[model samples]
Target chain A: MSVQPGPATALSMSSATPAIEAVELSKRYGEVQALDGLSIAVAPGTVFGLLGPNGAGKSTAVKILTTLARPDSGSATVAGIDVLRRPDAVRRAIGVVTQRSGVDPVATGRENLQLIGRIHGMRGGEIKARTAELLDRFELTEHADRPARTYSGGMQRKLDVAMGLIHRPQVLFLDEPTTGLDPEARSQMWQEISRLTGAEGLSILLTTHYLEEADQLAAELAIVDRGRIVAAGTPEQLKAGLRGDAIVVELADEVATAKAATALRAVPGAREITADGHTARARVDAGASALPAVLAGLEQAGVLVASATVARPSLDDVYLRHAGRAFAAAHEQEVA
Target chain B: MTTMVSHSGYLTVRAVRALVRQPVFLIITLMQPIIWLLLFGQLFSKVVEIPGFESTGSYLDYLTPGVVVMTALFSSGWSGMGFILDMERGVMDRLLSSPVRRGAMISGPLAYQAVTTVIQSVVIFVVGWLAGARFPGGLVGIVVTIVAAILLASALASFSNALALLLRSQESVIGVAQLLVLPLVFLSSAVMDIRVAPEWIQTVSTYNPVDWAATASRIVLSADPDWYEVLWRLGGLLAVAVVVGWLATRAFRTYQRAA
Candidate 1:
């Protein structure tokens, strides 16, 4: 089989550049500002993950970039076409796997592919051949003739991705692709996505609330909050750029939190002290070395220490520093 | 050598194939017209002496054409319910996300409804024939009547689907559809002739495309074929179909814009 040319091929030969770019894009739905002057650029042949809690406008951003929805203000270009002005061209250049899977449950898996291919103006033979290939790619060759409703959740999500890839678009937008899948299914989907991106060298923009999925799949990610981007960087950089490993010191009494924060600030290599309930967390250069001093400082201040643990800085830590709350805690609040 | 066959009729063929897949639905589509024929045919048969009524041999003959047209209207009016299902199920969104032309998306479902209308029309005609409504015009007349019913029904379905797009709510679309259909059927000469009806009713029927469709179909099916009447009624229905279809196009544009 012939390999699909990626961004590198075009870049190496000429001046073709970023596949998708949003310059301070904004969109509002009545009273709710879904996206607030968000800006990001995705290089050709790269996976750019939009990571945020639910209702953080990650899906909104994807919708604008894929040309399904337009931004109220600001400009977006996808695959060299203005999203709002030339949506038809943008539609031609990109494939979208929406948060809601769009596969027809009544139609057979193969029929679904053929139907999509035909709509894309593929000839009968071409659509048939491509349908066979997509079925094989998603490992649905056996179930190709069966109605899609009969497939497992993982199988359906896989087919969703395969459908997007059928036309070999320059850019692909996957909005929460593995959202409802079990861990095993999610992992399988991750592998498939990785293999396809690598093989075809396609630029992908994926929005996922799963932090680790962002870390594992995206070379770079933008952490979004409310209706704007809070931070943007590689997963390693975002984690490494934090002051230190998070050391959580739960005080014996809730009142010690404020006192402990004051006391911990004086300790060497500690930064960004925040107290919540009975727990006082501080970022330090080395949690192991700083723990004894932290304990000593708290003792001097007559603060009772109940528990203490030191660990490597994670995306959760970065999120906490940026958003003023733990990632999981913020996610729960959003869900509530 | 897999030479492609660009079936000019492929769109309609695919539409029929899709409609047939839903067997329960197909049966329901066929039954609505049959029910109207049986119920209204018997009721209006005895009440035909209300003066000014053209003496038809039986009420069934007068009602058959109207029932066929009403069935088409009823079937067409609910075409958008499928669209709502498509929307909720993500199938419609998937199609939009593809490189498919906007017209084709509208055509697929509309074509399917048209084909279903034809099948239902055929079933109604056969039942009417078995009930002693002799076809004086033979095969040509039957074919013309069926074609008129399909076109008129498909056109109405297109407009309804467009309204469905505008409303974007299944309950609202279905409610509005139900409210509009019964009135349109009643106001037209579907159950009784204009001559026997009150003056106000005759004036209102002039504006009802369902009346136009029924009149056209009845003209062709009746023993005395008034070519002028048939042509004029068919033309009026065609015009309504064009206008309603245009509204649907505007609805499509509105839907895409909002999305």
Candidate 2:
């Protein structure tokens, strides 16, 4: 088989460059600001995560970079093609698996793959061979002739990924690939996504509302909040950068949270103490050493130490530090 | 091969397959026209004897052309329902992200409407012939009848698709489609003569693309065929098809901007 020059061929020569880049991208929808000067650079051959809670603009960034939507005042490039000026060129080098299942419910799995391949300009033989391979790889061979709506959630998600890979794109964009799946299906999808980069040399940009998804799948991740990247680093780096463990204290009395905060202030090892109605939390360099001091201080001040625990810093702490609030709290605020 | 041809071929096949897979739906939808062919042909069979009803000897001859156009309108006007389904299912987003020819994306559904109309025309004409309606123009007349059906249906198909994207809601598209088709059909000569219609409706229907189709098909099916008038009406429907289809393609821009 002769491989003629195609738009995706240019992606190989651009291996030295970042696979995806978005600079100062902004988009506004009526009263909601979907993206505000958001930007990120993804290295070639790595899984990059744009992690955020619902309504945090993660999907907005994906839409812009994938050439499905345009930015108001910013620019993006995928596989070295300007997304706005040469969107068709960018499309040739990239594949997108949107948050929702895109497979035609009326069409069978095999027909879905064949249809997408034909649109990509693949020959009939190439389409048939690739469809067979994907159906097998995704373990969809048995149900290849069945309409996609009949498949299990995991099966459907697997077919969605296979559809995106029909053209062997250089970069793949998966927008919340495992959003609605159950735990088993979610883990299965995670495993399938992790294997895409092994032999294909494909760069991936993933967006998700689940923190564990980013930690488990992305090599590098950016935590997005309110249309901005609040913090970015490898999951380990972001967690380690917090410089210690977190000490959380829950009081028996909701009104005594302020008292509990004051009681825990004397511990020299503790810092950044804050409290809500029934809980108070602090950062300490060493949990084992700091636990006794924390308890003792509360006792001396006549504050009940209802319960205390110290755990290593997590991405939750990383986001709390950068955003000045707990990650879940911020997410709840947006949802509410 | 150009992307438009090859890409549209696959997409059109998908549409047709969807129809074939749901045989009951296809049957039910096509049966509506046949019901009209029998009910209207028999109920109003004597209307040809009424003054100012310029039908051939048999009212079925006049009603046959109307039935052909009605099948096209009813089927094609809901063409956007497919797009609404695609949007709801995220299939439209998938196609937009691919390098499918932009034209192919729009033409695929339009072509499906054309193909189905041809089948429907054949069915309607076969039934019309059983009711004693003779085609004075023979093969050319039958071809012209099918062409008129396709042209009118494709025009409504484009507008329906445009409304589907612009509204992005099945309920709203259905509402607007009903609003569009009822009046256009009533205003046109598809069901009745100008003398039977109110003066205002008759005047308004002169501009109705549906009437343009009905006029051309009625002429070509008549014993005294006016070839020039047929060209004029068919040309009008074709222009409307191109314009509305273009508008539907433009609606994609609106959808993408919001997506």
lDDT to native, each model: 0.81, 0.87
lDDT of 2 by residue, B1-259 (tens): 4768988888899999999999887887779888998898889888877788877568788888888888888888788899899988888889889998888878899999998999889988998898788888788888998998898888888888888889988986687567877777888888788777679988898898888888888888777788999998888888888888789989977877777
Q: Model 1: how far is A21 from its true place, Å? A: 1.8
All DockQ scores: 0.44, 0.75
Candidate 1 lDDT score at position B14: 48
Estimate, for each residue in A1-336, the C-alpha lDDT of model 2 and write its tens digit: 998988587666666688999899999988999999998999888899988878989988988887888888898889878999999999999999998889998899999999888888898788899999999999999999999889988888889999999999999999999988999999988888888876777899999878889889999999888888988889999988888889988887887878888887878978878787667889998898889889888888777767888888877787778877777777788889
Tell me, per candidate, how large a share of the native contacts it keeps: 0.53, 0.89
- Cα lDDT tens digits, model 1, B1-259, are 1111222133345456566676888888777777777776766677667767664557787777788888888878888887787788776677676656667666667667766777787898898878766667777788888778877887878877887898878886687568988899889877778777778989999988888877777778777888998888888877877888888888988887787
Top candidate on lDDT is: 2
What TM-score, over all chains together, does every model reach? 0.90, 0.94
Q: Candidate 1 has which clashing residue pairs, if any?
A: none
Model 1: which docking level applies?
A: acceptable
